[model samples]
Target: MTRGTGRGGSSAAARSVDVARLAGVSQKTVSRVFNDEPYVSSDVRRRVLEAAGQLGYRRNNAARALASGRTRSIGVVTLGTALYGPASLLMGVERIVRDTGYALRVVNTMEGDAAGVAGAVGSLLDQGVDGIVISEPIDEAGDGVDAPLRVDVPVLVIGAPSPVTAPTVLTAGDGADLMARAATEHLLALGHATVHHLAGPQGWYAARDRLEGWRATLTAHGRDVPPVVTGDWSAASGYRAGRELAADPDVTAVFAANDDMAIGLIRALAEAGRRVPQDVSVVGFDDVPVAAYVTPPLTTVRQLFDAVAQEGLKRLVHTIENPDADPLPSSGPPVDLVIRASTAPPPSRTTPARGRRPASPSPADTPRPPLTNGGPAGDH
Candidate 1:
């Protein structure tokens, strides 16, 4: 084997020919093994991998790209936020893409950035990505329909409608509405006359879906659809909305868009002398880590971030590998609603809803109780 020395006299980097020679295979067989092309026997493939491992050999992705005209990398356009939902989805995508043997390139776009998905996609295209994943959480549709983005590669858009016109476009994780519907339905099934809604900001497509699901559930059940209380997906906003809802005697149940808001709403209700599952019942979306540990363990719907990423990437990779084949079908995200102590049937008797009553104290100040009436621990 020909070997060269570096400045410090270290041996040259191990190449495919070295791996092939050690494995007793031709250089072409080594290429097939590394490229994951099918015709070789399982035993030969394993031997090639072992030889490469022993020699510390790494495949030259750049050289392969030059020969095949494919970068074997996937690009992701995600919202530049630390919020749990978007961040979790992006992490899931990264994990799955790595496992699929494709390098991942991520570009984050802020909510108010002028160069939005279009600019992000342009950057990925410049880098020669085989496919792209749009994990944007913003409602980019605006007042009018946005002109479809130009992309030559296959694309997978999660949780929202695709804004790009591409050779192959796939979608997954659009089950937020169904999960919200489950939350609302749970409240209704508990014999609450009407369930109030604490919606997320209208600027997000996720928030819109949750709001719509709440409204639709109320309408279907012939219950009065009260005015929606909007929040910015923050605990502070939920507290503000809770203060308003506390003043109304009719709000015996509330369906919050997320767990953070729901926790804040619960605190506000406590301060107003409204006891959870006693004077009021609450259901929240996103079974966050703190959901089960809060004063009154929060009942919530879980978002299937990993599941969405797996299904979406599977379809996207299939499309990239077989250009003429139809995209793989997607099984929608599961609707997992965790039932905890925060939700219950309404109070048997009428009680004052407005000011703090001396008899009733805030749950936040009280000692934490054991969680009961809880469901399975779904994905965080």
Candidate 2:
């Protein structure tokens, strides 16, 4: 019957009223802090938490659920993969959710899992989460399945379109296209006549977005859009594409869908005696940790996983708290193009033809200022 006992029903545990008394605040304020309700000042919240910690007080989530009809927990549906992008995003979500005072329940769906997103949602619903976050969902049906997915809780889909027909479908962190555009544009700005693309598999929405952005950039700039070479978001796939590309002298610059592919492409190019930034330039997405320490250093678009997760979760929590209000408008993720030593102006074209030309000066040969076009830059 006592608060802060959760479902244990302990009579001796410290209650919210005790915390409020110790923190020199009203019991109402203590409830607001524990419930994660908005409008509580940071100082008051901190004081209440300190008092609760001192007294070893905890929230009676079961009682609170009965009173407010909310479990105060969130469910996350993500692809069960070790890929850098998805894994990093899930970690960010985990970190931010803890700060929101909501218990997290994650359900990962594998590549061939039956019902994929729908099944994941059903499982989470059964567990009774207040909200759901679908992070980086791949296109399961490939050709766009027409069936609508049903979900009752507030849904936040990140980095992909919402597959569900929930009452509150909030979408955020779908800026891969914009970042891809920036990467492609960066190579083009460096004087490559037309940049080649090493695209990821089309199944992933992120990959499709990157491919779309690359194609759109070339089209908008009036450059020749080369035929796309698809990779499997792996170094080996990139190496294969690179081997094919290396045979053609026309491949001056390549915008890979991800950093691993770009690194593999560079290795393949090196084996073929095609010097990077001298004979060819390369740009990639997701500036991974080792991007800077590679042989030539990779120029890449930095994906802000933490920032995206933080922003998206904030909006999700807001929707959970205020059911009637419209979902907040996203200001869009910040685009960061990290300039390293791997990109440079194309080699000189003596004959003005599409054949193999002499190697030009590398981008590192001259001291150039940090270059940025569409968005922010993190020059190395």
Candidate 3:
């Protein structure tokens, strides 16, 4: 359907004369298919393929591939950096691509620039890649994307499409809303009247969505949404933001953008005489590898990075191979709040200043099963 038609809603129909002529068979013999000739055998099919190749004639794959099936190989474009989010996503994509028996062709953006991105994407198309998955940071470099090379191919733009240009796989907007609501709800469940957020840079969509989530949750719960502190997606920024909040004794709970910042918040809170769950409880997002290993594990939200990447890849290739297909929908698995030692009821609110130490979630709280390979993932 993507094949635009000309006047009278008609495009020039392809003729079989070329196919028969190239197959070196009579036009009548080729016509036998329309007549259901039972005599045609395997050898004849071979001749048809040879002739089609020689004549540069192709059966309308739209109708024919229904029988032959698509080829392997999917193209993907992502940030060149080995960041946690992208790295985790690639892990899932690699497993999926292998499981699907499709080869992966990855093109990293050179210098994390827009031109590099455009060039990588174009290279994938030139190879006739069935589909393309883009994992660039929209806040970092995706917002200004000027529509992928050409719109004729199916493209599943990850993290939402720019305006109404093409199909997309998104984990922002509503996804962020859910994340915020869930995070705030957990803190509220722990008895905090309000939650303060140390947000990632405003340019990032995650930062904005997280902020919205925090605000919306606070509004819903009739709690105050404090002014958000901005960070550079670094632990240093988290430390700085933590110091600011630590100066205020009334601030009992904080939600950082990701695990790295959460780590920094820990240092600041300790220096401020706050004993983690015992003083100011903290929750973080992304639940990175180190989250659980910290002195006191952080209670955080786990973004289903694998699911996001898989869905993005699936949508991109589908749209690329089937341009006329309806647009892909926004999809993401729900975020799970991994309760750990980092969060607890507020100190001033729940504990009399004379308690020895706060209680902790025992093995029952983090009953992670063993991984098949016997790794930390399986160990509690």
TM-score of every model versus the real structure: 0.86, 0.88, 0.69
Ranking of models by lDDT: 2, 1, 3
Report residue 234 deviation for candidate 1 (angstroms): 0.7
- In model 1, the runs with Cα more than 4 Å from the true position are 1-10, 24-33, 36-46, 349-380
For residue 122, what is the lDDT in candidate 1? Answer: 96
Candidate 3 residue 361 Cα shift, in angstroms, is: 10
Top candidate, metric TM-score: 2
Model 2 TM-score on a 0 to 1 scale? 0.88
TM-score of 3: 0.69
Residue 161 in model 2: lDDT: 80
Worst 10 residues of 2 by lDDT: 369-378
Error of 3 at 93 (Å): 1.7
In the range 1-380, model 1's lDDT, one tens digit per residue, is 44534336589988888788889999999999877888999999999999887777888888888887899999999999988899888999999998888999999998886458899999999999999999988876564376788899999999888889998899998978888888888877667888999999898989999999889988999999999899999999999999999999888999999998999999999999988978899988878888888878888887878888998999999999889997788885687777877876667433445694634424442222232134543323
Clash pairs, candidate 1, are: none
**lDDT by residue (tens digit), candidate 3, 265-362:** 88998998888877788988887878878878877777777777666665665555455777567555466777777777777555644656645545
lDDT of each: 0.85, 0.86, 0.67
RMSD of 3: 11.7
lDDT comparing candidate 1 with the true structure: 0.85
